[model samples]
Target: MARNPERRTALVDAAIEVLADEGARGLTFRAVDARAGVPVGTSSNYFANRDDLFMQAAARITVRMTPDPAKVEEAMRPTPSRELVADLMRWLVQRMEDDRTGYLAMLELRLEATRRPALRNRLTQPVRANFDESARFHQEAGLPGDADAFLVLYLAMTGLLLEHFTLPGVLIGPENDLQAEATLNRLVGTVVTRVIPPS
Candidate 1:
């Protein structure tokens, strides 16, 4: 009935933590309120229902996980497009590694969406928007790749981030950050350097 942006944000963030820690099944208004350290019913005051809370949290996680624009611009300067793409991929992998829990929670939400048509429909828009925005950014940066190439890169990178962060030590090979970055670079290079066919 009233505006409480900060409280709503807090509730959504708490919901994310609970979703990540306890999976989608454990996400309730009560759990969110507890995680937010707010009084009982606080989460309900903000979110009308569990689905609302989850969808909001999913959007917030993407917002929090997006690359910083200033840094992206900085990386763009004095670097070739291929090299810049590698830099961008490195940044993306680092973000997932740093916020493993949030990403895990996002994955949980994605799985939950499959069973709920309404939620899946809501999520579809933002998912497409992400790809659209990425394609726009690549074009603006004068990158060699097209939206199609970036789409392929997105799919590959999503798998890489999901596996690398979700199950540490499962990837095998060297476990250090440099080695991981190198691997990401090669993967990114492969995508960015590929020749796109006429549309």
Candidate 2:
């Protein structure tokens, strides 16, 4: 395979866009090359086969979706409380809005995985590790609630994002974005107990 790191990364990123736009069946070396503006057959040089391309695209999206380190630092600076937890959740929502394509690509990969056992095996560990790390982080950060809280919020927000991106009108109609913000806050509140203000 081609070994130029920068070029490889670009090819993978381009492949992600193709996967998001065209789904697994639509992903091809030519499509990726066109999307990346590279010469035809460039993607094939970087990737061994379609499976290689799919794995690389999945890895790229994982990096893209990871939480911002500076933002994590800022969140840690605050006293760990329910409000801070809510803020973190809001940050995730904001990220989805900003990187909608990456998330869509991830969703596409998930669908494709259902049909490809090798891809399924490749993805299972990272997805579980992310969840495990998230639970550990919540505990270490002294955030309100436990691993269960994080799990619930994670699943709820995943469902919300799926609906918001795939079928916007279903869950939060008309003013979708605005409703998503409010709905996220409510979800956090329900999962993590609210802080009572001093009278």
Candidate 3:
């Protein structure tokens, strides 16, 4: 049977909204149907199981969450590496600021991937793509193309950001833009210095 691309796209978008708003624990076929404004069985028809639905939702959310290179480039036009890195960090902090729910959903998916082999594979694709993008971005910024270092920094930044979001006051004194940017700036500066050698 031919699939309806428009309907599939709508369902995926709805799934992202549900996952972002309610996390994986709250994701249900009926909920997705409600969000998509389709019959309950429609979700099942598009996705055979919850895992499949979650996988698609995660992929769509990842796409939506990732930084837009065009926007980054526009913002960083004629900027040097140091300034560019700062800009990138600021952008990341802004994203983390705007989407705490989505961040928590990603954390839930990460935890679930550990126990579910199928989910593991599905999640790994986005993980690898993120790392690849980071590596490419660093290389473009005239930094060494050290995949290991990129991976380490990526893991550290993501961990710190997720912790900041999830644990809130536990990790930082106050929850504010200045505090978040300061923490991210310090962490990003440290990682950049460690990974990118002085010219």
Name the candidate that leads on TM-score.
Answer: 2
lDDT of 2 by residue, 102-129 (tens): 8899999999999999999888879999
lDDT of 1 by residue, 1-199 (tens): 4369988888888888998999999999999989999899888777788878878888898788887889777877864466667667777777787887788888998899999888788778887888888889878877767676777778877776776767645553565778866766665556545533322
Candidate 1 global TM-score: 0.85
Error of 3 at 151 (Å): 3.6
Ranking by lDDT: 2, 1, 3
Question: Largest lDDT belongs to which candidate?
Answer: 2
Candidate 3 TM-score, true structure as reference: 0.79
Q: Tell me the tens digit of each residue's lDDT in model 3 across 99-198.
A: 6656667777888788889888998988888778777877776654366766776777777687777775655667587876677667667766765445
Better of 1 and 2 by TM-score: 2
Error of 1 at 24 (Å): 0.5
Score candidate 2 by TM-score against the native.
0.90
lDDT of 1 at 151: 78
Every candidate's lDDT: 0.77, 0.81, 0.74
- Candidate 3 residue 28 Cα shift, in angstroms, is 1.7
Q: Model 3 clash pairs?
A: none
**Ranking 1 against 3 by lDDT, winner:** 1
